[model samples]
Target: MPLTAALLVTVPVFLQAPWVRSAPMAAALFTLPLLALALVLERRGQGQWQQLGVLLVGFCGSWLGGCLFWGWFRLHPVMHLPIEAFALPLAVAGLGGRWRLAGAFYLGSLLGTACTDGVMAAAGLMDLWPQVLNAPLSEAPLLLQGAAIQVLHPWPLALVGLTASLLVFVCRRLWTLGGTWRVTAAALGTTLAVDTLFLAAALVAPHLSGLI
Candidate 1:
């Protein structure tokens, strides 16, 4: 269940990422249906459905955050995390309540995001963010590929390895807690997996990398 919850975090990357890019308003509005579904499931009164509902509620927060940021602030690299963290306060408060599942998942995803952005900054790829995004469609892939290649340099590669190791360590520790912590662990682990795959895609096939 925790692993499944973790994988759910990636759904938005495939669906919301491109959708928000093309139709920010529509993407933002889609949050309503997701929230409605969550409410319905929670009200069903079955344990399994109620749990799934809680996970979906967490996913809704992530989905809405992505839409809010990628919709209007894609070009501003600096605003990315701040915007993505729009639900931070709520997520934190949800930690000790019945909504711990939601809190764990959101925080895990956010941690993954923060780590990814930190790596980009440390690896000198931050400057390329706006450049690639604002470039012509034909030109963006090349710019993205160049940025990925930079990751192969000795210093950047070492930093990537170090950051990944730290995240893995955290995930292992979280897994031992055996409850919502498991959910957090799974989400964080899946996030790391997704980031690795996205970087690989950017290097080999930037057009399919989902950034443009």
Candidate 2:
């Protein structure tokens, strides 16, 4: 999710006149929300840090492995799906921490995914399909592939950031306060929401044009 937010925020800066010479630094600074949950919910126990480290490694390793394996097989490489779905299981089994944080992470990842997609749309890189009605924001026709936004799109990318961040906050806050498995279940449910939205959009788009 942080990656999504970072990409959305950074891509537009590069598109503008000055170009973001310090884009990476700006990205790191802007990612405080992602790190904040970990900081505030720090566990205090015997070798807690060690456990956290292990959890991080295992979760990341599992996700990367899954992604690589899927991609190598020409599977439609998934995006936020793997990270959100597996992160909780890995953390629970490996680190044995509170489910609350896992819930937060998943919800945060969902928000992040939306932001990433929004940014990609704003940058003319991809299409959000059904929700996007504007021709400028509409995706490429079905036959096209890659980089749709080089025509100097006039739409501001800031809208993506603003809307995505708001959604993320709402989801994340709900996650922090929700029930144990319920939050996890909610995130999993949202994964369906995203997929359904995509499918509906693709079905409705004009057959001749490519989807962004």
Candidate 3:
């Protein structure tokens, strides 16, 4: 699961490189590694195929839901976060085990996606449309210039981490309160950890590479 998480977190960053971004099939090619890793992980009994499938579907559904909602109502992007936070847990709940792992991976993807944007922004490598809608809405000016990461300021990222952590900790205390509360805590906690790791990478990698 950790390996899968790592791959999920790093793949987006890999895809953001100029050379990979230029290749029409780069995204598909990059996904191959994840597919391979998923297969290996499943074989090792790290997680079931159903869980992985659920995670992927839930993750994709979150984006699709956002797009559809945005298209229909054009709500502020800030509104979409709550929608996703609500929808994702519901989407994974049916899987019936420690499904928070799925949420972790899903959120990990968000982190990777964010880090990828940050790297592109620092390197001036972004040339395509923003890969995630949040980037355009949150960092409109940067998007216009074919850059990314303008929205990845530390405070907002830290706030998200703090919120997720608080929710998870609070939920843990509520486990005896109900199943729903327990699940919610797991989902929020896992998501928070994954997001923190990615945010840390996004903030630090640029400095390490002298891109900032």
lDDT of each: 0.88, 0.38, 0.42
Which lDDT tens digits does candidate 3 get at residues 1-212?
Answer: 34333443333333333333244354334445554554454445443564554344334443444333334322343343454344555444644654555554454444333443344344443433333333434454333323225434565445444555655566467455553343334444444454455445444442322111
Worst 10 residues of 3 by lDDT: 203-212
Best by TM-score: 1
lDDT of 1 by residue, 159-209 (tens): 999999999999999999898899999989999999898889989999975
Task: Give per-residue CA lDDT, model 2, range 1-212, as digits (tens).
Answer: 22222232223223311222224334333334434433443444234453343223322333333333322321222343444344545555532454343433344344444555545555654533322322332443432212222322355335543554565566566556554433433443354345334434444543323222
Q: For all the candidates, what are their Cα RMSDs to the real structure? A: 1.2, 13.0, 9.8
lDDT (Cα) of model 1 = 0.88
> Which residue pairs does candidate 3 place in steric collision?
none
Off by over 4 Å in 2: 1-47, 50-58, 73-97, 121-124, 127-152, 156-158, 164-212
Better of 2 and 3 by TM-score: 3
After superposition, which runs of candidate 3 have C-alpha atoms over 4 Å from their true positions?
1-47, 63-164, 170-187, 207-212
Give all TM-scores, in the order shown: 0.96, 0.33, 0.35
Q: Distance from true position, residue 120, model 2, in Å?
A: 2.3
